[model samples]
Target chain A: MTDQTTNWPDHLTGDAQPLEVGILLYEGHTALDLVGPYTTFALAGMKVHLVAETLDPVVSDDGGMTIAPTTTFDDCPERLDILFVPGGGMVYKPMLDPATIAWLADRGATASYITAVCNGPLVLAAAGLLDGYRVATHWASRDQLARLGVEVSTERVCIDRNRFSGGGVTAGIDFGLTVVAHTLGEKAARFAQLVMEYDPEPPFNAGSPESAGPEIVALRTRFMAEPDTALRNAVSHVLEQRAATSSHPVSDENADPAAGIVND
Target chain B: MTDQTTNWPDHLTGDAQPLEVGILLYEGHTALDLVGPYTTFALAGMKVHLVAETLDPVVSDDGGMTIAPTTTFDDCPERLDILFVPGGGMVYKPMLDPATIAWLADRGATASYITAVCNGPLVLAAAGLLDGYRVATHWASRDQLARLGVEVSTERVCIDRNRFSGGGVTAGIDFGLTVVAHTLGEKAARFAQLVMEYDPEPPFNAGSPESAGPEIVALRTRFMAEPDTALRNAVSHVLEQRAATSSHPVSDENADPAAGIVND
Candidate 1:
């Protein structure tokens, strides 16, 4: 073990201003998606606020845990350094909620960095924040994101301008570190990684459909059929509203044929 | 992409019984440690209960988040398939609490699988459950575990008999999948992995002291000085009490010289 008394490098010890992070919390959102980044930012001395529609305890999708939100949408700070959204099984609920869409639009417009993990980009896309922007989301939800007019990337973490997104649940950790490296320098991100022991070793190589084989992928498709159907409906609703408000009527050249269709 | 209509293999869709998982929640506990495993097990179809001293919301160590426990210790099931603990900065408080230690001792005696992540093993050691058992804990807390008479292993996840212990905060996810693979079979674990997209790509290669370099390690040590000091004091208190009650007085041959001394 290294000596504990050794002086750290100046880069690692510089006094930096704390970042103001706002993480959105909705009923049935995945806990890991929110907690992964929350842990990373909090460990790096950032002030994180769990923002929700209300201040009540928000229950996760599995109904196994409840997390209390620190601030409500109406009360959250207007100018946030980072505004994040986490995805879950019932992610379509938020995508279809006008209030949630309005909140995302309002906060995302002024936030220095707009971010999401897993299917969270779907919410942002539905709120028109990801219009014509390159984004990443859960592999299973990529079709839905593409349907919403966002250029989807399958990379674990994707960054386009001020918008950052990660694929699936566990990718949030890597995404958080990437954000930290970008905002606070690589040294700060490395220090956070060390403290959290971010080294990973998956016992199996079936984390993705390409590696899990066709059989497992089919099983997941069967399990996710209902949610996929709901997402398709939600995407159609959002697109129709956008088209209706357009001054120019929808035309074959301008309209996307696959806008509402669920790609198999 | 694989066809969504493809039939899933019988081996992947077996009718398996859901495991009952009990996760301990406490004041000042790390959010990621608990949420990592909780998300894994829940996604795998396990019935998870966030067990705590009370049903009220438990505030995390960072003070930015609060998690609600589903069931109190007294109301928890008599026999759980898995009993889990998560570690954090204030882990010593639970280690020193007689009620918490007694509860762990009682539940651990009957639980089919006793497990923990991060410094959680320290509490198990304090309860005398880890006596003579090889365990894994956070690297920084190894000396404290040794003081409790438990043999420490540096592996990220260690399994001695039925006690499963993991390293630092993020190790909970890997440890959870290991437990799932053991109890539910590799197919189930692999499916869970796919669902959560557990593929990790760390932005930095600084997860351990050796990998993080001396400067980063020293920086962490400086940041952790106060917690380390408190942990040493707690270890000393537990050790002195154990020595006073021993009929055979503490001897050089039988006692650990490192006991009550914080190893730097």
Candidate 2:
């Protein structure tokens, strides 16, 4: 028997493993989008696996936190209480690749719950997992999500059943906490929140892409538009790929590493 | 002239050397307390150095984010803008260690600013920097600061001249953004905040030491009582250390690794 506290309930008749969480890591992804929730849920003692298309070290959106992934998408066990997705640079190839998108579309239906943080919901939209669901994406990409028939919101986090979304990188922490409460019940979640002391007080009180004054918002908006279009094109390709095949289109044997290297 | 964005005419400049941001690592430090801010600042493209009594990787309160120090107290540079103290675990020894406390005491006069997240201000208090300043620590540790003549507050972040304190670990991001604003201007800070999408909406809207339900709060209050005693004892020792020293007692002998242990 392991000595992990909460690992084993002394009175339970059958043995149970802690919920395994798989967080997707891709090149140029927002480190905060993943690290924020990674810290929150891991602190709550969930079994988290940082999974990537391959086991290579994934570079973050910025240049820091060069995280070497723990498992490839193919090798990760099928069981997961939550599948967390983090977004960063416009790495659209993974979502655009026919085989990869087919894999996401296949497993997503059977996964415990799937979530996207920041632009990560783009991947979900590509997988056809977000159709008709109210979702949230980063401010820059919200319109693109809307175009795909996903009910997009400006809220920090929007949850529609097993599909979850977050506004931007920082919102992932809150989204992670929300799921913690949803999965572990109030007591455990409350304890985890207290330990984190998750209340925020931004000095300038400006966070939204819109509310960040006119100039800065306009600048980022323009800079991000081109990349968004490119990503949208990629997702559209995947939607067509899913339509061509009714069976699970993605297979471990077919996930192409070349699907990496997009706008990032 | 460095090409770094922080080197702009509006930005502050010094040596062309790497921008040094020190995270004071100690045993039992909260993982996110340091990791959260570390991820943010590191992702911001800052040169982050984890400093400790010895260059051993420090273990966090939750045994997550085990990190090796880039240097030790002695080797840390003389001038720095961001001096981060992360809270959790046995802070008493490092706070009282003449080397660590003296280094802080000497630099406290010229540092760009000294900031603490969660109970970290206790270390600042140990150095006597918080004697007359308004400060905040982990909710449980506020009373401990009051005993040292610190004007304690319930605020998530208490920003006095050259001194910044947050309620606990999760406040690190907002505190970090606030520090960025103080160092840089509103525009740069806003850009960073926007890039990060600093929107925060928690799942249950409960994230304070006091905000958790009565049962969890009571349980935590009961659980923390014992550790708080250790913290008090450490505080007393630190006070004595300060009394024994005239001024600037910490040695800048160059950072040294702890004996018998090696960093990975």
Candidate 3:
């Protein structure tokens, strides 16, 4: 994809196969966030692999889509082209799971792209990958990203080279398409989009918080009151380094978030 | 489900645990056709049990997603609220599998919705479900639908009550959105649409056979030459037989194709 933000992998391991897209699924995670990008990347002909902490099923937040992982963290493919992180109400738990966080951080160290949807970027922030980088995620998590020292935006989708971030679950398609253009090439991306009839016409106009109008946003925001507090308190503690990392290089463990995290 | 363009089960075992979603996976089936809707119902809190004919990993047409199934046909969930029929290039093989066709026909007789995507409607047609009903399928399959005596259109999505039809792979999202609207209340669906940010704004305006421009359309048309011939012949064979049921009765093998199916 020769788009505004992309970097084609320069080399491929003989057994590397095609670009492998690994999506992490867990309990209470929003199913749409994972499935949306799965559709887009799979449509684009990328090798999309659904992964979990174990071989068993990873249940979604609402008790929807129970996906069985093809491989476990211990048996993931040698590497990944893109690592996708999806959000749900229980993200705090998954983020705190050392196995899950280490997997994201380890993979992000060398993966072609590390992306997140909804509040998923928070996980990345907690992992220290977002330090000194611009990122985006769900609008509700925008301020938290600023607190993590990353340039955050309310855009429906953001593609910052190796860091792909989406506004919400629906942005997965756009993120996928854009990533497709970046990874496979524009022609192939266009070809896949054409075949899938990706030209979407939403019956209603509302989508993002900014786009969904006032009272609706207020009601939605009000609904999320509990999770917001939980995220702030839980994240501040579990991903404790958020305090240190924000004030210092991600490598530092004593940085003060209040003093160091960016606001403007 | 009341429309009865297809069969509804005689004694549907409303057992919640056993109802499974049998997703067809093979090379060339559009990826989104399965995954998009997979998450939709999954988010709505339904257990989307993935079923295949075998235990082998299923490869998609574009070689993108290699999905492992939860169960095979024989071992699948016995009772179900929905027997989702995902569409793609592999749909043609369902006609070749009496076990699958019979399973679809049997489960469809009782399941809540016998939904299909892209060319999945053809599987419904192959199972003699679309007979005498206004059914929809992929845009490229319109002519084949006409040959089968069903009214055809290029609408991005079509929902004939029990038989939800997605226009193409990407239409799965729209279909899922519509399904949420249908099964759950509009409020629940709207809530999902809001979280998903489902107001899709594709970078490119190409998604339909007609909308894909003439050259690309012609290329696709040429590419489909072989499938068209086979589909035409197979569909004709599926169209044979004489009905013996009453005017409003169900499960007439030679059911009229133009009657039960509605025009939207």
Provide the TM-score of the second chain in candidate 2.
0.80
Q: After the best TM-score superposition of candidate 2, give how far the Cα of residue A168 lies from its true spot, in angstroms.
A: 0.8
Q: All models, DockQ values?
A: 0.60, 0.39, 0.31
Q: Candidate 3 chain B, which ten residues in sequence have the lowest lDDT sum?
A: B4-13
Consecutive 10-residue window with the lowest summed lDDT within model 3 chain A: A4-13
List the candidate 3 regions with Cα displacement exceeding 4 Å. A1-17, A25-29, A49-57, A68-81, A210-230, A242-264, B1-31, B42-83, B110-114, B159-163, B218-264
Instruction: Tell me the tens digit of each residue's lDDT in model 3 across A182-251.
Output: 7766654565567677767565556765566775566556556777777776566744555454574332
lDDT comparing candidate 2 with the true structure: 0.68
Highest DockQ: which candidate?
A: 1
Query: What is the per-residue lDDT of model 1 for residues B46-141, given as tens digits with 9 covering 90 to 100?
Result: 778998888889999878889998998999888888989999888888889988888888988888888998998878887888877788888778
The TM-score, computed over Cα atoms with residue i paired to residue i, of candidate 3 is 0.75
- Model 2 lDDT per residue over B1-264, tens place: 123445522222224344567778887877667766776565344567778778665565645444457787788787776888888866666666677777778767667778898888888888777766777677767666665557777777778777887777788887777666666545656766777788666776558745676776775665566667788778666555655774744221113212211111
* Winner on DockQ (1 vs 2): 1
What global local distance difference test value does model 3 have?
A: 0.65
Which whole-number lDDT from 0 to 100 does residue B56 have in model 1?
82
Candidate 3 lDDT at B164 equals: 67
Instruction: Give the candidates in order of DockQ, highest first.
Output: 1, 2, 3
